[model samples]
Target: MPSPPSRVVAVVVTFNRLDQLKVTVARLLDAARTEGLQRVVVIDNASTDGTAAWLDAQTAAQAADGPLVVHRRATNGGGAAGFETGMRLSAEWFDPDWMLVMDDDARPAPGAITAFHASDRTGAMAWAAAVYFPAGGICDMNRPTLNPFWHRGMVTRTLLGMLRGRGRDGFHLTQHDYDARAYRAVDSGSFVGLFVSRAAIETVGYPDGSLFIYGDDVLYSLAMRQAGGQILFDPAIRFEHDFTTMTDADQRFKPLWKTYYHYRNLLLVYRLASGPWFALVLPLMVAKWTLKVRFHSGERGQYLALLGRAIWHGLIRRTQVDHAQVLEWAEPK
Candidate 1:
């Protein structure tokens, strides 16, 4: 009827990181000219560093070449919020058959967009993702390695613990450099080079804005899988990512109040994905966090203090406002 909204919508969320973000847009535009991407939406969080103005110029230059919508927010909303806003806008305006979520530091190898179309996102195949990480390198595009137990908020916790300081374990967005031979799917990955079909969006909807920060992609991917959407990591498609900005200890990692959302969302994801049985294990998670903070790192006391407050807030109330809110989200797969 209405042309079924281009089958592919590309959305990018950026903040003040103008220099880094420039790379992603250049790649997307290049892909559009060669591989033919139809629609793209970029949401710029209120950036004081002239990012908004620069984007304005970029959009004007590409307006005729591609249908790109650029919107600038009044203030910074964390990556989760920016992504939520971008996804919603992408679905409403461009409504591509497949939505590609790219981050400022991530990208695709040649034909990465084509690999998305080749995944066959029809009837049963609801979710189609690219392969991630080639070798010990940073994350690349993902493969179809769906985790039987897909949990968004927690995927990083596991991967981070394993990837922490592992010498030679370079970082990338898609994580494609890990294993380039086959395609697989795990729980989730950074938003830098994510590809989603319209069918999956119709069923999964936008990522939970309530998350406010981290864990949105993990949660979104889990929803797609539970809805019978297949998460594939096509080896042929390579999305590039430069994910070595900060560390977990960074207060601005998500936001100052990220200590709250990270814990709260962790509980939320575990509850939804794991079920009552898993939810009951929240206490153990808390305990482990406490121990890790104390014994694992010197910030034990501070970690416990902050984590305790977060646990109380998440467990006590249905919703809470975190004073800290800024745009930022990414991780190694």
Candidate 2:
């Protein structure tokens, strides 16, 4: 006798990227026929783009047992909140054994879901997919990494790399890493194509919505690891991220003020991963930020002020995801 299929629900969080969402949904639905993907819940974050209308039309056109379901949020709560909303609704209605989360622009290729389900993740809490850019380059941002602070060899190699001016590049996955045929253990992963078991959610709870964006996935993955849950990166299951533009060296004051959330949430992720060792790591992080601002940014004084504010708030561990506060800092004075 054969084993029964696992019940899986895909939870997609969309903001304003309707075009990408359409492509993602179509591919996911087509893949469902063979992948045991029973349901899909799309959480729309108040998209101004005709996203709501498109969803309504799609839902109406499908059968009563159609896999697609839509949740239209009144306010844009960002990706973290959107994922939380989608997951909660999925559990309530679909009651799936597993849930896969991704952004609107992250599209799983054909057979991606089937490949993921076939992988032997016996006790993993979550599994990350190898994310490549649409043009077939590795999506650097979604590469799963080992926590250097947790492993001695990783820490030593990471220190050497930083001394060689590689910074934290040692922690990120390389092309060779992404092309591996076997499953590899990882400390953290992004939401893009992340599949989480119901047991994992029950153990660690949902991703913190207060993060708004940036590093929420890292924090959640760390929490799962802390709870004795394993996270694996299975390269066989791959997704494409629609990131055509390159912005590697431009992570500073040019954005004027999104740096607040970036650095603040990063600190939160670092603190979560570091535990009692956060005090030891704090000075190094601060010094690095100071140097980056001094050498790279054009608006030195304003950038320093924003960095100081972010560090202070991160120290105090503020959890409020205030869009207004971020916008106030983002606007030019």
Candidate 3:
């Protein structure tokens, strides 16, 4: 007899994006039966919109065996915290074989989850889907990357590519790789379409909630790799990220306070990526981020101050800074 279908649960972290969350949930529900989706655990990060009301209604309308599970936070804890809670809940409540994690604006393509179950995962502990924009192009930000520090050839190629201005394609998956049928080994990937096995979670634990946002997925996935867990990028399993793109000219943090988390968490990511060579990599990373302040013009002072604080806190591995404190610091003087 054929083996039973794998039990896959989806964890979606949402905050104020009710419309997108609805789409994501609807897609998951639509594929529930066909894809062996046991449950969809949605972590609402204190959304003020009608999200709570909608979720409540959905929960009330569900049967005893309903697949929808909503956990509404009393306070906004950012995506990282939301995922941490969602993943824990998923394992405790649904006991799925694998947990699929994504943002509110992302969802798997039709039959993608089925394809995931059908694929030969082999030695991989986690699998990343080929995330693409709604318009059918590769989502640059969601691409999986190889850790250059882990391999000498990767380090040489990445450094040479950076010197030649080849962008992240040196370290990240190439277009050719995306179009291929086989799974490729990746050191880290975004949360948009990442599927983590229960065994991997038991080994590496959940994502760091203290991160608030940014680099949490990379750090978590890198931790898995560091623990000898292989992560594979499966092009056959596709996901769509319905996110707005920013041009290079308009690529500054919107709230400004976000700069703190972005830079601080990035430091932790670099440290994890470089391992013992973090000290050697620190100056170069800091310099690259520091030079970006020139583009902020009017907010250069505030930007520089945030960068300084981020560097200090990151070096000390401090993630206890309050959100309100970051907001106060970002205020125009």
In TM-score terms, which candidate is top? 3
Off by over 4 Å in 2: 244-246, 252-256, 294-302
**Model 3 clashing residue pairs (backbone):** none
Order of the predicted models by lDDT, top scorer first: 3, 2, 1
Among all windows of 10 consecutive residues in model 1, the one with the lowest summed lDDT is 324-333
Provide TM-scores for the models: 0.75, 0.93, 0.96
Query: Which candidate would rank higher by lDDT, 1 or 3?
Result: 3
Best by lDDT: 3
- Expressed as tens digits, the lDDT of each residue in 106-212 for candidate 3 is 99999998898786554688999999998999998899999889877887787677667674877899899999988899999899999999878889999999889
Task: Candidate 3: count the clashes.
Answer: 0
* Superior by lDDT: candidate 1 or candidate 2: 2
Q: Write down the lDDT that model 1 would get.
A: 0.61
The model with the greater TM-score, 1 or 3, is 3
